[model samples]
Target: MGIRSVLSKPFAAFVVREQREWEQKAPDYQHKTLKNLVSKASNTVFGNDHGFKDIRTYDDFKKQVPVRDYEALKPYVEKMLTGQNDVLWPGKPAYFAKTSGTTSGTKYIPITKESIPNHINSARNAILNYVHETGNAKFLDGKLIFLSGSPVLDQKAGVNTGRLSGIVNHHVPGYLRTNQLPSYATNCMEDWEAKVDKIVEETIDQDMTLISGIPPWVQMYFDRIVEKRQMPVKDVFKNFSLFIYGGVNFEPYRQKLFDTIGKKVDSVETYPASEGFIAFQDKQDDPGLLLLANSGIFFEFIPADEYFNETPTRLSLDQVELNTNYALIINSNAGLWGYSIGDTVKFISKDPYKLLVTGRIKHFISAFGEHVIGEEVENAMKKTLESFPEADIVEFTVAPNVTPEKGLPRHEWYIEFSKMPADITAFKSSLDSSLQKLNSYYFDLISGNILEQLHIIPVKKNAFIDYMRSIGKLGGQNKLPRLSNDRKMAEELLKYKE
Candidate 1:
């Protein structure tokens, strides 16, 4: 029942075999395999139902099928929403992982029995690869705390669909599942207020060694720990061994976390989405991440330079060039083929194919056509925060606001500060000057008068979460969208005059 049995020696051996198979595959194997898989998947799902048959080659497939975002799958999703036996997958979906996308409302993404293998394998690959790289499986031996969403299942009629957290909770190795931890089924099903209360209660007395989740949730937990104990945050997490996180860049929040904890714990960044888990940190000092290519995915990269243009060229594993940024296009086993998830990444090295996640291709502000990526804003924020080490800027968002007087646009920064700065204007000027120096395009856009005013609005510590909660989006898998691409939500959140 232990991890040793669940992830047996033979299972570990199989992972090594898979990694080798991945490395030795022919140059065009990924492309060919993906094209074939997509054809089959389309046949399995849409072809029979929709009466479309000939989906074989890449060009043929592309021509026949229109590119679809998550929203377009609503009819299929709604069918599965009833917990019907055969709407999408072969059997009833065991759980529905609730995820929010840009254009889509909250999607109850089906996590069928067939799709469970992908999730399990992805999770295993992350762990096994960590062990393979570091030669240490004991790193996860201590009490691990996952800052997950509410585990409470819906008791309301027709609301019993399983969520991603619930699925993960149900599938974890029985031996590793601790009695000290709260069960998602029992605790997460409670009312939202009660769920948070249970989480707070369970974690308060535990000797938590490893922490994982979205950065904001982790921060919230630490805040609660400090408030309850009335002790410096460092004391509570003194025994913590690792901090594993994903969903957003950790650069902006790292210093604050370190300052709060007063100790440097190993931070592992993983690339996990409701669709699939993509990659994880391969080496301790190396900035590049290692893709779990062997785990139910065949990856493709579209060169970053050509990403925005029509008919961009895609490179397979062997075809991918080194040190260049590219938009990630994944063909996962869970029915997404040649899918553009909009994430952009760059290869730092190719020996083991280590990559650095640069930004999201779709998540950008181009009011004046500057094309500001997440990395630029992240780097600018890091530099600005480093300058004011004493300031506790919890979270920040950037938006391009248009002024009607001359029909000009500008970058406005909304920051949540734990402590109010005496010299707010000076702070704004410093941030603006640093940002302008950091990104020449942004600088030119501002200087040439295309983008007008640069403003910074400071708010209370939990302002962002409070704002999201007020919109009925505080809990579950949804995150506060930073780098507000369209600025609609940003404008709404910014209306609070503080």
Candidate 2:
């Protein structure tokens, strides 16, 4: 083992031990985090507006500050963009993570000096935790490539601004900098396709070990590497073992990704967002990510079923129940108070507070009052894939076909397949049946003739890729919506129908 790997084991052990202690005391950490955030921002515009000074308890904080999505919070952000100080956070933000917004077009999420370590350290700890658990730190000696956005920042109100991934690039530690791949010049290329081509050239013959990114973009990079090397990615990077990813559910892309790599490797899934680094898969055996409760962010859970209610019940960490889906809200040091990041999660284990990202609060198909979530569809795909081993998925999305020209309106699944199922008809039946079993409402809708069985539309290869490209969201923290309530995306996808 290299010197770094030898030293890493002890450090990793220390980190793991520390993390366990905090995990057990997360409720205490969360209470303290809330108190700190409220106290620090008490003099700021948002704190004053929300009566933060009088917020003595979780109930008081909830009453004083309502849950607000990006649009709802944009006025304060606007003031900040115009060079206003202490608008949301105590001082001017150190940087702004520019993200594609839903209703607001473009969003600038603040990253304060206090909150930046939560993003950086959480990622580092995830790697260290992996090393601690598996006793495999040899990957540290090899090149680690994080397929991310350009590391270019723009000046906005005297603050550095860029994509979250790009902003993070600047903060990469010096030790890992030597082992990091895809030269800075290559990473700075804005065009994703061109950037991937350059990255393939730069790292094709390197001692690459750890590869990290959103699964789809990482798949694209693997495809390019295979095409260039004329071998599987595993063969090209024989030392490669760790695959770290976040941004979306990895289940749908799991089979295809391993197939392309030619073998299974240890992978870590994280829950890093522009808002904060919320969670990471701490245990190799557990599917749930351990919530980062002490990471400068106070969390609140609004039951997903009641999220659309006029006044959804918001519960603190101690009040959450196991196996119940909840919309995640945050009051963070970054000046976001009761901010809804749009994600929904489910607690699988409360002992150390481990949870799974179920889906998004806004991303669901409920046309006929059947709320089909991302987790259910992903689970259906995973189960169906097991039954049909030959089939491999490239990318897919689901949307409601509310105004079909034929009989009943239905859920349309636009899938781009790498290998089509041998019996497409049976595959469709199996997928639909799996989903129906997981969601009773969907099953009832189909049985009661309120909606037709889900229809699968196999689009041309790279259809989703092309669609994202057309919309200027081809790369860098842009996630394709898993499902939409409306038919806008479904209608647009028909052009690529095979």
Candidate 3:
């Protein structure tokens, strides 16, 4: 390695050390501090304007404050947009992280100066934990590539602010920044159609060792690289060392990613949303991802199965139970309090508050009243993949097609493949059998004849992206809807004749 590379290692080590100290101190100190912060913010925003007199205890805060979604905070966002700060967190909003939410539609989530620290610190903890797990910080001295969203954000006044990627881009230590690619990928111009070309060109010859992004987008990049170079993915990514990702579960794409690389590389998972950066994989052996408890937020967990009608129980860091899934609720200093972000996670342990993301509670199939979660679906897919090692399924979606005339509801599978199955009939049969065996609900529904049939629709490699593009939704952050729970959306996807 060159002298520049040698010098970069110590700087990275210093960052890791600072991050470790922060992580160690956070869980212990955050709860009380965050409660105080929330109380102060509540007083500032709604003390006189609204009815909230005070928010002292956890129970007092929960009972007094009604849960607010993105739409509920529109006025606050509008205030910031107009260059005024009338809510929690002082100073003008730094950037709005664009998020594609399930119920709320596309949202421009406000990221203020107060909120930016959470994102930065959570990301730093993810890196520090990676180094701690591998016992090395200099595992990848080569170029670090982030397959991120468009760096530029379009503003109403025609003066564009930087996107989250651009903000992070500016913050990265100048010494470590790579010259292999442009400071910013310009091809992601005003139009979304131009982004793929830019992404493809920038990633082609770069000797990238570390890559970070959502799995689907990264897979698309690899596919494009393969097509352009006319070479196997192994040749394109021979120097790659670490695969860091967030925004979605990696289990579905695990086999494909491994196959493309031709070997195993360290994989890291991050639990982050436009709302805030939450947790990250702390130890390689442990299934639980460590929560960034200290970052200007008070974390709370409500039982995953808890309904809106029922009074939800919120667990503090010390009170959280092991092995039970919970819907994450946050009361952050950045303005959101007792907010239901919609994602569900299960605790692996609570001594240090390690968690495993189960899935979005909204994303599930309940055709015959059999609530099939993301974990069950993931396991079922893994079992089916294990049975058919020869098949290369790229992306898949499941929909519950209820036929009242037939007196049953069945699951219809839409799958995209890089290579066609030689024994298509047998593959389908095996998948059905595996799913039935894995999930008791599936088995009972099939055995009881409530689920009449399983239909598999095969599509071209890029069919899903084409579908997404047709809807004017295509980018790094956007994903092909996994389990279309909406009846119309599910029906439309299932009845896709093409």
Clashing pairs in 1: 96-162, 151-184, 151-188, 152-188, 152-189, 153-189, 409-451, 409-452
After TM-score superposition, what is the CA distance of residue 117 in candidate 2 from its true location, in Å?
0.4
Ranking by lDDT: 2, 3, 1
Stretches off by above 4 angstroms in model 3 are 2-27, 39-43, 47-53, 101-105, 135-140, 156-163, 180-187, 190-193, 404-407, 420-422, 433-439, 490-498
Tens-digit lDDT track of model 1 for 1-498:
346434444565577667767645534455666555554455445445533366555556556544444666677667666554444434455567766665776666655556677776666566665556555544355566666665545521254454565567666666557632655553455354456666768766766766777777677667777778887565875667677788788887787677666778777788877767777775678777776655556677889778767677766777788867788876555555446777888887666777778778777777776777778778877777677766767788888876644456677788888755667777777777777786788789778876754788776657887787787776555566568557786767666536
The global C-alpha lDDT for each of the candidates, from Candidate 1 onward, is: 0.67, 0.93, 0.69
What is the lDDT, from 0 to 100, of the residue 237 in candidate 2? 95
lDDT per residue, candidate 3, 1-498, as tens digits?
655545545655776667566556655666676666665565455433443456566667667766666677666666666665545454445666666665567666666677777887677557666765566555346677776656666673222354566556555556456542434746246444466567678767877777788888777777677778988666886777778898778888888877776778888899887778888887777767877776777887788777354577777777777877788887776666667787888878656667888877678887677777777677777787777787777888888777645555678778887665778888778777877876788888888987865777876656777777767667666666567554665455544434
- Candidate 3: clashing pairs of residues: none
Would you give me the overall lDDT of model 1? 0.67
lDDT of 2: 0.93
lDDT of 2 by residue, 1-498 (tens): 888889999999998888988899999999998999899999999988989899899889888999989999999999999999999998899999999877899899999999999999999999999999999999999999999998899999999999999999999999899889889999999999999899999999999999999999999999999988889999999999999999999999998899899999999999999999999998889999999998999999999999889999999999999999999999898988889999999999999999999999999989888999989888998899899999999988999887788989888899998999999999999998999999999999989998888899999998998999989989777889988898888888999999
TM-score against truth, every candidate: 0.84, 0.99, 0.88
Root-mean-square deviation of each candidate, in angstroms?
4.0, 0.9, 3.1
Residue-pair clashes per candidate = 8, 0, 0
- By TM-score, is 2 or 3 better? 2
